[model samples]
Target: MESETYRGYNVWGHAILQQEAILAPERFAASGTITRNNKLVEASGVLGLFNAEAEAEQAGLAWALAWIDSHG
Candidate 1:
């Protein structure tokens, strides 16, 4: 997980590890969350699967910024 402050909101990008089979390659699941005043404002369910942890995290951050741009 990574965190940043944007437009007075606290945003987080999460990368969760995933594996389908024993021999299958590992994957990452993307998700995001936004908060203000230490209160929950919004959270994404799963955004998508990504091959790299950084990619997944960046996707989540992008989603969060977009959400803030429209809603904030």
Candidate 2:
């Protein structure tokens, strides 16, 4: 239900999840830039600067699915 790495915008890294596709595939190394959703929540830090479009989309969907499985 998940992978080790993901891509988004211009970044890539480990993908974390919450519940119900709330938070997108966000990879951040900083301590700021927070993100949230109805069920998923997290932050898109510096890691986002090295992700690919497909990786990000895949991670995003994966994150959402994980969220649904966990919180749904």
Candidate 3:
């Protein structure tokens, strides 16, 4: 998980590891959250699967920023 403040809102990016079988390559599930003043503003379901954790987290962050832009 990673956190950053944007436009007075706290944004969180998360990556969850997932594997279906022993031979399967590991993947990450991406999600995002937004908060203001310790209050929950929004959260996302799994955004997508990524081959790398960093990619997943970056996707989450991008989603959060886009959401903030559309809603703010």
lDDT of 3 by residue, 1-72 (tens): 888999999999999999999999999999999999999999999999999999999889999999999998
Whole-model lDDT values for every prediction: 0.94, 0.35, 0.95
User: Scored by Cα lDDT, where does model 3 land?
Assistant: 0.95
> What are the per-residue Cα lDDT tens digits for candidate 1 across 3-68?
899999999999999999999999999999999999999999999999999999988988998999
User: RMSD for each model, in Å, please?
Assistant: 0.7, 14.1, 0.7
- Candidate 2 residue runs with Cα over 4 Å from true position: 1-50
Which candidate model has the greater lDDT, 1 or 3?
3
- The best-first sequence of candidates by lDDT reads 3, 1, 2
The TM-score values for the models, in the order shown, are 0.95, 0.32, 0.95
The global Cα lDDT (0 to 1) of model 1 is 0.94
Better of 2 and 3 by TM-score: 3
